[model samples]
Target: MNQTVVSYLAQYEFFDSLLALFGGNQGLLTFVIFMIFCLAIVGMCATIGGLGTYAERKISADIQARIGPNRVGPYGILQFLADGVKMMTKEDVMPFSADKFLFYLAPMLALVGVFATLAVLPFSTGFTLSDMNVGIFYLIAISSLVGVSVFLGGYASNSKWSMLGGMRGASQIISYEIPVTISILAITLLAGGMGFGTISAHQRGLPTNWFIFHNPFSFIAFFVYFVGALAETNRAPFDLPEAESELVSGYHTEYTGMRFGFFALAEYIEVFVVCGVGAALFLGGSNLPVDLSFDIIPLQLVEVVIFMTKALLLYYVVIWIRWTFPRLRVDQLMSICWKYLTPIAIFNLVGCAIWVVLFNGKSVAQLLMGGGH
Candidate 1:
C-alpha cells in the first residue's frame, strides 16, 4: 500500500485517541488531517516563495558588492512581507485589449500547477501528502501547466513582446523537458520505480548510497537534470522567457499588481520544488548518514530538517547560478537542450540500464564493498 501522512499517523497510538475524539469517524478524521497538512504545506511553500525574492535581491547585491534591503526589519528579513503588502495594495491593471478570461486564469493555473506537485514531494518517509506509485510522473505532467500558463498569459495580453516571450517560453520549456524527463527516467530505472518514496528509499543510509553516486552515468545524469530543470523553471541563464533587456518582462509585460505577483511567486516556488526533487532524487533525501533501526516522531522531524537542508542548499546554488551566469541567447538555449543535453541524457539513460544489467543492479559503492544484490 502507498503510505501517506494520514496513514503514517494512523500507526501511532495517539491517533486512536484522536479518532475517538472525532467520534470514530475515520473518514472525517482522515479528511481533517489531510486538510491541515495541505494547509501547512501550502503555507510553508508560499512563505518560501516570498522569501525567495528577498534572497534573490540580497544574493545579487552581495555579488555586485552593494548593500541590499536592510531598512525594513532587522537586516531586511521582513522585506518580502513588505513586498507582499505592496503587491496587494498596488493597482491591478489589465491591458484594454487583453482577453479577460485568460488574463485572469493564467496566474491561477501557474499557482495551481506548482502547488499540486507538493502532494507527492517526499519530505520524509511519513510526511508526504500522497506517496502515489506514479509520483514522479504526476509531478512532470502537472508542472507543465506553468508552460501553458506562460503561453496563455502572453497570448491574452495582445502585445507582440508578450506573444514572442510566450512562444520562447513554451518552446524552451518543452524542449528542455525532454532531457529532464529522460534524466529522471534513468534514476527511476536505477530505483526500479517511479515513486519518489521508492527512489529515496533506494538511496538511504549514506551519501555513497545516493543515486548520483550509483554510477558514472547517474552522476552525469544529475548535471543533465539540473540544467534541464533550470531551463524548465525559467532560471538564468535559461530565463529567456522573461528577459527584461529585450522583452520588457516578457510574458508578464502587461501584468500588474497581484496578477504579476502571482507569476513571480509561482516561479520562485517552482524553483524550490525543482531543487527539492533534485535533492531527493540525487542526494540521499531525508535519509540520515547512519541507518536507524526504529522510527519516531522526533526522528521523523529530524529527517524533515535534513531534507530541508539539502533542498535549501540546492536553492542557494540556484540563486548563485542566476547571479553568476549571463543569460543565454534563444538559439544557444535551444542548442544546449537539443544538441547537447538531450543526447547526453539519452546516453546516460542507456548507460544506467546497461550497468544495471551487467552488475545485477548493485550500485558502484555496493559492488566495491563486495555487497551482493
Candidate 2:
C-alpha cells in the first residue's frame, strides 16, 4: 500500500485524539487531512513560483553588473508580490480571432499539470502527499499536460509567431523527454524500484551511497538527465519554444494579465519540480549525511530542510546557466537530443543493467570498502 500523510500521522499518539475528535470516521478524517496538505503544498509551491521570478531578475542583474528590484521591499523581497498585484489588476485581453475555449483552458492546464506532480514529490518521507508506488512514472505522465497546454495556447492564439513557438515547444518537450526518461530509468534500475521512497531509501547514509556515484555510467546519466530536463522545461539554451528574440514570447505571445502569469508561474514551478526530482534521484534526497535510527517529527522537518537546500542549490545552478549561456538554435536543440543525449542515455541504461548483474547492484563505495556481495 502507498504510504500517505495520514498514514504517517496515524502512528503518532496525537492522531488518536484527532481521530476521536472526528467521531472515529477514518475516511472523513483522512479526506480532511489530505485537503489541508494539498492546500499547504500548493500554496507553498505557488509562493516559490512567485519568488522564482524575483530570483531570476536579481541573479540576472548581478551577472550583468546592475542592481535589481531593490525598491519594492527589503532587498526587493516583495517584488514578486508587487508583480503579482500588477498582473492581477491588469486587463486580460484576448485576440478577437482567438479560440476562446482553448485560450482559457490552456493556462489552467499548465497550472494543473504542475500542481498535480506535487502529490508524489518526496518533500520528506512523511510529508509527501502520496508516496505512489509508480511515483516517478506518474510524474512523467502527468507533467506532459504542460506540452499540451503550450500547443493549445499557441494554436488558439491564431498568431503566426505563437503557432511556430507552440510547434517548437511540443517537439522540443517530446524529444527531450526521451533521454530524460531513459536516464531516470537507469537510476530506477540501480535502485531496484520506481517509487521515490524506494529510490531514496537505497541512497541513504552518505554522499558516496548516492546512485550517481554507484558507477561511472550512472554519473554520466545524471548529466544527461540534467541537460534533457533543462530542455524539457524550456530553460535557456533549449528555450527555442519561447525565444523572445525570434518568436516574440513564443507560445504565450497572446496571453495577458493573469493568463500570462499562469504560464510564467507554471514554468518557474516546473523548474523547481525538476530540480527537486534531480536532487531526490541523484543527491541523496532528504537524507542526512549520517543515518539516524529514530523517526520523529523534528527529524522529518530536518529532512525537509535538507531536501530543500539541495533542490535550491540546483535551482541556483539552473538560473546561473540561464544567464551565462546563449540560447540554442532550433536545429542545434534537436540535434543535441536526437544525436547525442539519446544514444548516451541508452548506453547508460544498458550499462546499469549489466553492472547490477555483475556486481549484484553494489555501489562503488561498497566495493571500495571491500564489502563483497
Candidate 3:
C-alpha cells in the first residue's frame, strides 16, 4: 500500500494501528484518514447535490415566473433537507405485483453506485481519497453502474410502465456509452500519457494550458463528452427513458417513500458526477488557469473552486437544456448517437492523432508560431 494510504488509515484509532502490523493493518493512520475522507465526501456531495436540487427548482420556477419552494425555509434552501427527512420517515412500499426481492434491492443498488463514484474525485491536488492507478477507468466503470441500476429498478417494479422505462433507459444509456467512451478516449489520447496525477501536475498554472484549450481537438472533445454524458445520465431531451407523459416516472413508478426518494436523489448525484468528471478532464480539475508566482489562492482552495465552478456551470447547463429543449423521439435520440456524436468524436480522435504526432508535445499555437526560438 502507498504511504499515504497507510497514513490515512492510521487516523481511525491508535489501537487499530496494530491491525496494520499483521499484514491486515497496513497502516491504521491512512485507513482512518480515508474513513474520514469517505464520510466527509458522502455528506458534502449529498448536501451539494441537495443544493443543486434546490437551485434547479428555483431556476425552473423563475424561468416560468413562478414561486418555487420558497416558503419551506429561507428561499427554499431547507426544502431538500426537509424532503430528505420526510422521505426517511415515509414507509418503504412495494407494489404487491412487484418482485419482492429485486424491488427492495434496486434502490439500494442505485444509491450506492451513484454515491461511491465521488470517492476518486480530486477536490484538491492532494485532497482525493484514493488516487488509484486506474482513476479514469474507475470513474467510467463506477459511473456506468447508474445505467445498470436503473435497469434493476425499472425491471424489478413489475409495471408495464416501469418495464418500458427500464428498457428505454438501458437502450439509451447503452447506446450513448459508445460516444461517451470515445470522447473520453479523445481526452485519454490528449493527456492520458500523463496519469491523473501527472495531468493535474501538467495543469498546475495558467488556465489555457488546460487540456480543454490545449488544441482544437480537445475543444471539440468536450462538447462531444457533454452530449454523451447527458444521454448516459438521462437528463432532459436525452431523457426519453423517464418521459413523464410516456412512462410515468419511468423506473421508479411503483416505488414509494424512502425507496423512491433514494432513486430521486441518485439522479441528481449522477448529474454532479458528470459535472465533476468534466471539470477534471477539460476544466483543469483543481488547477488555476493562470500563471501565478505563489498560486495567490492556495492550490487546495483553488482546486475546490475551479473544479466546483466548472461542475456547477455544467450542472446549470443540464438544467437549462432540460427546460429549454423538447424531448427527442426515440428515433431522434438514436439518430443523435449514430449520426452526430459518434462521427464527431471519431473525427476528433483522428485530429488529435495528427496534432500529437506533429506538435511533438508542444502547444498548438506555440508550434504554429515557432515561439520556441
lDDT of 1 by residue, 1-373 (tens): 6879999998899999999999999999999999999999999999999999999999999999999999999989899999999999999998999999999999999999999999999898889999999999999999999999999999999999999999999999899999999999999999999888899889989799999999999999999999999999999989999998999999999999999999999999999999999999999888989988988999988988999999999999999999999999988888898899999999999999999999988888999898565
TM-scores of all candidate predictions against the true structure: 0.99, 0.99, 0.90
lDDT of 3 by residue, 74-140 (tens): 8878998888888888887778888888888888888888877886777766567766657777778
Question: lDDT of model 3 at residue 205?
Answer: 64
Worst 10 residues of 2 by lDDT: 364-373
- Candidate 1 lands at a TM-score of 0.99
Model 1: residues with Cα > 4 Å off, grouped in runs: 371-373
Q: Please give the clash total of every predicted structure, in order.
A: 0, 0, 24
lDDT of each: 0.94, 0.94, 0.79
Q: Candidate 2's residue-wise lDDT over 83-174, tens digit each?
A: 99999999999999999999999999999999999999999989989988899999999999999999999999999999999999999999
TM-score ranking of the models: 2, 1, 3
Instruction: Indicate the worst ten consecutive residues by lDDT in candidate 3.
Output: 1-10
Candidate 3 matches the true fold with a TM-score of 0.90
